[model samples]
Target: ELKVEQNPLFLSMQEGKNYTIYCNYSTTSDRLYWYRQDPGKSLESLFVLLSNGAVKQEGRLMASLDTKARLSTLHITAAVHDLSATYFCAAEPSFNNDMRFGAGTRLTVKP
Candidate 1:
């Protein structure tokens, strides 16, 4: 079974500040994905990290995966109010073909 843990469930940041959200998984995974969800909105795909040390960035967000450590990170640079949302990280293990997701991190960017 695969399990995921995300820390600091809630974050409040000022605009122009930076932060990083972490996702840790138990078990080996080769594929990982990041997603964003706004209040009352469906999830939006952010990034797909396919290999160890893989990194992807879009806008002010960057996601990276470390397969060997069973961990992934999402870094937000120069956060903006428009970036406020809930973020989730999911990992798919090679053995079971199943994906497990972290509890999610809710971020609020203030002006």
Candidate 2:
């Protein structure tokens, strides 16, 4: 079974601040994906980290994975109010081909 964990279930930040959300998995995973969700909106993919030490970035968000550690991180730089949303990290475990997602990190960027 693949289990995923995330920390800082909630975050409140001021504009221009920086923060990082973490994702840890219990088993070996060959792929990881980061997604963002806004109120009443569907999920939007932000990054697709495919291999060990793989990293992807778009806008103020960056995501990376370390396959050996079964861990991934989403770094937010210079946060803006428009960045407020929920972020989720998902992983597909090689053992079972099942995908699991971490509990979302809800972020609120205030002015």
Candidate 3:
């Protein structure tokens, strides 16, 4: 059985601060995706880390994957109110098409 875990499920920070969200999986995964969901909105793909040590960044968000450790991280730099949303990480194993999502981390950026 494959399992995913995310820490600091709820985060509250002031604008312009920096934070990181972590995703750890129990087994080997080929890739990982980071997503963001606003209130009452659909999930938006933020970043896709494809290979070991793969890193992707867009705007204030950056994502990295360490396949050997079975871990991934999403880093937020100089966060803004618009970035306040629920963030999720999904891992896709090499075996099948199945993807497992970690418990989302709900973030709130205050002014």
**Tens digits of lDDT, candidate 2, 13-64:** 9999999999999988888988899989999988889899998888898898
TM-score of 1: 0.96
User: What digit string (tens of lDDT, one per residue) describes model 3 on residues 23-103?
Assistant: 999998877999899989999999888899999989999999999999999999999999999999998888997998999
Q: What is the lDDT of residue 24 in candidate 1?
A: 94
- Residue pairs clashing, model 1: none
Candidate with top TM-score is 3
How does each model score on TM-score? 0.96, 0.95, 0.97
Could you give candidate 1's per-residue lDDT for residues 11-110 as a string of tens digits?
9999999999999999888789898999999989999999988999899999998888888999999999999999999888888778888999999999
Candidate 2 ranges with C-alpha deviation above 4 Å: none
Candidates ranked, most accurate by TM-score first: 3, 1, 2
Full-model lDDT, candidate 1: 0.92
Rank by lDDT, highest first.
3, 1, 2
